[model samples]
Target: MDERVTVLKKQIRAVVVAGGTDEITYQSEWLGYLPFPVDHWVEYQGKTFSGDFPFDWTLDDLASLERTGFLEKLEAYENPEDRFDRCIRYRVHIGCA
Candidate 1:
């Protein structure tokens, strides 16, 4: 597994959660900016937020997510069969927004 990916994910999460402000909270923004689909809700920073599908994307688009390091963390685990959903969820939950 690529330790870099795991480290990056944690770094991203830390930066996001630390950006909270009185008027706007970045904790939820990550989940909304993801370039993929999601289900009913997302949970992060010890809280839960509702979610909706990003859109219906083509195979090429889905592939691009992986090609572009969008799924690097999940891929590093080397369990595609089990981590597919997790890959998407992590993308949605940790997107930089």
Candidate 2:
């Protein structure tokens, strides 16, 4: 697992434990304007897709958590008219901690 993913998992665990909630959402904006690398590619369901900044890293990390049974994606929403208007809901599996 990527170190970033590990860090993210820890952060999520802390938040869930403190808030006593099993759900969390991941969302970000202005990624294209960020200084981070924008050239990222991901293959999902045999389709290749590309995204900038957080989108690139965030998607991969969340998928990793899901694969490890740490989280289960409940839903995802994206607005083509406003790229930043997007969010993904996930159920955190506290037991997996």
Candidate 3:
């Protein structure tokens, strides 16, 4: 198994439970995004916010999360026009609003 992924997953869990703020930018503004899919996804004001990980995605980490699940929702760019574009990533919405 991937140890780094495992470790990172644990760290992310801690961050989610602590209740804090973190900003994740994809093609648009998504606030309170949870890297895990079990989290709730909501839209507030003019931006989108994802609460806690949903039951299905709660146990998944970067490597373990389903590649096709919600991943397809992400915007993808070839040759990445920007820095955030080139890297394979997921957004985590932290804290409670």
Candidate 4:
């Protein structure tokens, strides 16, 4: 794999391991995934924010989203560490194949 991709994947995995919700967004052509929809759109700091996961995301894609204020409202609302601990286990057990 490309070094950048590998690096981003690792970072995302680490975030997931550290109790952050690390699901990929599918609204942009960043990765291939099913769409997660949003019901309401909100504006903050003069920018519009919605909750659609971008598609086929890479670090570059996420960075663009962050720059565009899409992730401005992102935050941990629960004990995500424990949730990630349980949820990330499934991902950890998966083989690259």
Candidate 5:
């Protein structure tokens, strides 16, 4: 397995162990199963926005989505110490992918 995938899995495990819940509405029919809430924020075109990350998505899927500039990672949300901290948040560019 890729090291990044391992790291991502660990991050997700930490968030779930910490009691994170799904709080955002499903954003895409193609992207299903978001186990964690979409609580992270990102700035784009001078506007801040939040988005959902599919819980079952793999890193390869993210890479494909990102190649189209449809997803942004919210690195600030990776802290496991924070109770609200969850898996890496992906700001999905809705309708684009």
Candidate 6:
């Protein structure tokens, strides 16, 4: 067996011995699932935010969205922490594999 796998097994055993549940109901993914359909078009801060799913936020009016909390809850697929945070809604990058 691989060294990393052995180390992981030991860690799992430690957790289990400490009364921690090894059965993870929630597994972290590259993207998060959204319940609602994403709008193709959005008008914000006098700017037209239009595109497909997984819009490029870097080209958006981030200042306004940050102030208005429009996309505050949304996170990129490359960002794994926000997806597991559970404190806010996270959007998936639809185009990514």
For all candidates in order, the CA lDDT equals 0.35, 0.66, 0.36, 0.32, 0.40, 0.30
Candidate rank order under TM-score: 2, 3, 5, 4, 6, 1
Best by lDDT: 2
Worst 10 residues of 6 by lDDT: 88-97
| lDDT string, candidate 4, 1-97, tens digits | 4454444445434444555343433222212234742222222222333222233334354444344433332332323443211101112211221
Highest TM-score: which candidate? 2
After TM-score superposition, the amount by which residue 78's alpha carbon in candidate 1 deviates from its true location, in angstroms, is 30
What is the C-alpha RMSD, rounded to one decimal, of candidate 2?
9.4
Report the C-alpha lDDT of model 3 over 9-64, residue by residue, as the tens digit.
44554554554433222232223347732222222222443344332432234335
RMSD of each: 12.3, 9.4, 13.0, 14.6, 14.6, 20.2
Q: Estimate each model's TM-score.
A: 0.24, 0.64, 0.31, 0.27, 0.29, 0.27
Which scores greater on TM-score, model 2 or model 3? 2
lDDT of 2 by residue, 1-97 (tens): 7777777777677666766557776664455665854333332222232232233365678889999999898888877986766667788898895
With candidate 6 superimposed using the best TM-score fit, by how many Å does residue 43's alpha carbon deviate from the native?
39
Off by over 4 Å in 6: 20-22, 31-97
Please give the lDDT score for candidate 3.
0.36
Show pairs that collide, candidate 6: none
Task: Assess candidate 4 and give its lDDT.
Answer: 0.32
lDDT of 6 at 81: 50
Runs in model 1 deviating more than 4 A are 21-97
Candidate 5 ranges with C-alpha deviation above 4 Å = 1-57, 76-86
